[model samples]
Target: MTKVINIQPVTRIEGHARIAIHLDDDGNVNDAFLHIMSLRGFEKFIEGRPAEEVPRIVNRICGICPWMHHLSSNKAVDGCFGVTPTPTGHKLRELCQTMAHINDKILHFFSLQLPISFSGRIVILRFGMSLESLKRRLNLQPRL
Candidate 1:
């Protein structure tokens, strides 16, 4: 008989999601799926709002990637207004977006990937340890 394991409210990230692991009759893993259930009505919420304010309002779509939402909203508003950003302005926006990407990657590595990767091997420290100590324990070298 086939079986399924459902893990709900996946932590260490924004919004609600779940993971479904399907098992074969012999108990071997068959397939898996990730379901995201966070669909806020930003479209309706932003109706009739000023173009300049839309970016700020829509940035709340995802706490972890708010800059993405903000930048996308700005692009949409720019298209609607038929306006183009200056070269410097464009460069600044790209810099901010890149920084946001890096921030998200670091947060995910620390909060989600590390724990999942070392699920059974992670040691629980009664007293907190330094980042360098933790990296040494994990045998992870700093990457440039």
Candidate 2:
């Protein structure tokens, strides 16, 4: 007799996958298979949009890596049209991409640490509004 062990919907990562392990009569590890069960569908999503608009539109695919998708789509579209960026233009985009990667890393690091450190404590997120304003809004500061 043989049995299969299935692990579905993997976590701690962006996408989905399934892993299956099969056992032989002896119960030792027989074989394993990995099945990718998720797709981003950026192709179908971007098909009807104008090429010029793709850089901005493809950005909606993933919030964390939007800048990478934005720049890559733009470069691919340019190549499709037989256009090449100027040396300075290429350098600038590369610089901006490096900076975007750095920004994403810092934000993700803070987010992953927030729950462990803060627990249920007062917290304010979102862009704009100063720390003092957030403290006041959340009533964390002592009343005057």
Candidate 3:
């Protein structure tokens, strides 16, 4: 007989996902795979689109990475239009990119990194053990 195991809607990711483990007759896991069942085909749909439409189209690819998509698509638009972004536009774009980095870093620290680092029943204890060592590394903490 076959055995099937499922981890439904794994909670930690930015979006929904499913994990599957298939077991053979001896009940050992013979196969494991992860699937993101939802469709966000922005990357696929971007192909063959008009060059001018890239900035508007790709910007919606990921709500979390819109700044990156915007930056990339803006470059594509500039290339297609045979024009360069003005100095002011470049400066503004740089500021947005910097802000995006800050947001992503916060997300990593609070939601992903910190949780894993503090795992187990005595999470506070684990964190306490490393806190002093971590505090000493000026480079590890983000500069406000």
TM agreement with the true structure for every prediction: 0.69, 0.60, 0.62
User: Rank order by TM-score, top first?
Assistant: 1, 3, 2
Q: Candidate 3 lDDT, tens digit per residue, 3-82?
A: 88998988645556899999999999999999887987877898998888788887776776678988888987888789
lDDT of each: 0.82, 0.75, 0.73
Q: List model 2 lDDT by residue over 1-144, tens digit each.
A: 789999886543455788899999888889999888878788888887888989988888777778898899989899889999999999999998999989887666545434224443435455686878655545544323
**Candidate 3: residue pairs that collide:** none
Number of the top candidate by TM-score?
A: 1
Q: Find the 10 residues in a row with the least total lDDT in model 2.
A: 113-122
For model 3, give the 10-residue run with minimal summed lDDT.
118-127
Per-model tally of clashing residue pairs: 0, 0, 0
Task: Flag the better candidate by lDDT, 1 or 2.
Answer: 1
Error of 2 at 61 (Å): 3.6
Top lDDT prediction, candidate number: 1
Q: Residues 1-144, candidate 1, lDDT per residue (tens digit)?
A: 689999998876788999999999899999999999878888898988998999999889888899999999899999999999999999999999999999898777765567456543433432378877775666633332
1 or 3: which has the higher TM-score? 1
TM-score for model 3? 0.62
